[model samples]
Target: MAQPPKGTYEVIHQPNKLKDLVGGPARMDERLIAKAEAALADAVSKIDLAETAKDSIVKLDEAVERLQAEGAEPAGPERTIYTVMHDLRSQGASFGYPMVEKIATSMNRYLELGEPGQRGHNDADAIKAHVDALKAVVATKMKGEAGAIGQQIVAGLYKISRTKSK
Candidate 1:
């Protein structure tokens, strides 16, 4: 077979808007870090993690029920659960709830690995366990590992996930 002619492409470099805006790199001094930390603390304080997470967990529970009703198929509820879990994972750490982040991460992985409609009763139970864990975290306002209890909660969730039948 004759080889097709190679096409030549021109490379274009785009200007760095951020660099232009900031001018140059600045050292992260202690004072700057302190200021940033204070600002972050203030912003974090404004967020009611308990209320927010509880609301999301409620939605997650509803989605879980819908998913179970739909036989764990790919549908609006699955997407809703995934979205809620993702959002929880992202916000959990920032809000000082690392356990929430951990559980949500596990939930997301479960959703990702299991094929729609192929999930079984154990899978739904595992998901429910995740939801329960999240609820416990929010209800207790658990944050920053929560010591042995947090470790146990996360470990228990993993155990449930591992036991899920195909």
Candidate 2:
């Protein structure tokens, strides 16, 4: 290998365009941050979990009907039900509705148990119970654990799911 001649090499530094756009140093304006936080709080306050839950319940009902009517054939309606419940489970806590998340989590677990596409008659009943619980939680505007009654409701649903899965 041939070596480069001395005094013929040069080193160059490239500036970050993104950092320059954001005013560099990764420093944010406190006033801008405060405004952003206020806006976020306003947006979060406007998020009506009840309304979203109600919509999810409707979707669940439709999916359950489709499942019962279509029977357990491969993924079919079970997949649809799972998808809806998954969304409910994921968003419940973020929206300040832990009960919704808990119920949906139980339902998701029940759906995952046993055979992939072999939901029994009892399984349908269990799903209906979960849906009903979701409706009740939303109707009563239950929020965050919901004290003793909420605990009972979640526990009862989990028990039902376990029994039905077995």
Candidate 3:
């Protein structure tokens, strides 16, 4: 696919290119890396435990359900959910997990097409699937085997969060 114009979001899929850009796995002090990894995992776990993702999924589900119940086409909040899903899809691929990026892209496509009947025609199931996939990737990284790629992703997110806070 052609590259997205400057300032526009694009899904990048070349793992080799990403690895090059991110730098190949570098050896580091095991204990220090482990500590950082633990801290990052804790942060992500807290996010999950707060149910922010689950709540988003539930909101979209409810919106779809309400539309179906009312015998009206999905609107308003449902479209907003799709818009959010689209924005998320655009960024997810750059976060280090190709699988997650793929799932998010699929979810975006499904929502863009107006979620067809499968599990009550709700896109929530698809959204949940993407969330679950991302969680799985994070879980693997938390196991200490994700190596440098995982560490970089976590550290980058933390850094971004810190910058935004300031």
Candidate 4:
């Protein structure tokens, strides 16, 4: 068999084309959503809390502070902090501390995209925002604080990153 020219390939627009899949505004069962959210809250509340999360958060705060002092020079301490952040990202949700998970996830995402110890201001500020939020979450013992304020925190951080960060 002979190979075809590699200049181009066909474009499939079917996925992009909106073929009248809907004729009106989307509908959602608010009751179901509310009920599911209530169930999730209940389950999260029942989770066995890990005392170590608070201690780790304190350490995480210290690490972030060190990173701040370092000023965008990625190194051992920074990496350690990010690793801890990653752990929080995974464990917080499971331990009924979804705020921790959310803040950690956001911090991890920032670190993933924006390097520390370089272009330091935006990343530092954003990371601090997440850290501050996580501090609140951990200190508050994972209450219902992971609501609108969390989203607002992320949004503000995102804005800061977009405006000044690489």
TM-score of each: 0.76, 0.71, 0.34, 0.58
- Give one digit per residue, the lDDT tens place, for model 3 in 115-136: 3332233444444444454455
Report the lDDT of model 2 for residue 73: 55
**Which residue pairs collide in model 3, if any?**
none
Off by over 4 Å in 2: 1-39, 70-74, 114-116, 120-122
Candidate 3 off by > 4 Å:
1-50, 90-100, 111-166
TM-score (C-alpha) between model 1 and the true structure: 0.76
Top-TM-score structure, candidate number? 1
lDDT of 3 at 12: 75
Q: Is candidate 3 or candidate 4 better by TM-score?
A: 4
Ranking of candidates on TM-score, top first? 1, 2, 4, 3
The alpha-carbon lDDT assigned to residue 51 of candidate 3 equals 34
lDDT of 1: 0.80
Which pairs, if any, clash in model 2? Answer: none
Q: Which stretches of candidate 1 lie over 4 Å from their true place?
A: 1-8, 15-34, 70-74, 115-122, 163-165
Residue 4 Cα positional deviation in candidate 2, in Å, after optimal superposition? 33
lDDT of 2 by residue, 4-80 (tens): 79877777888788887888477579998999999977876898888876777888888677656644453566677
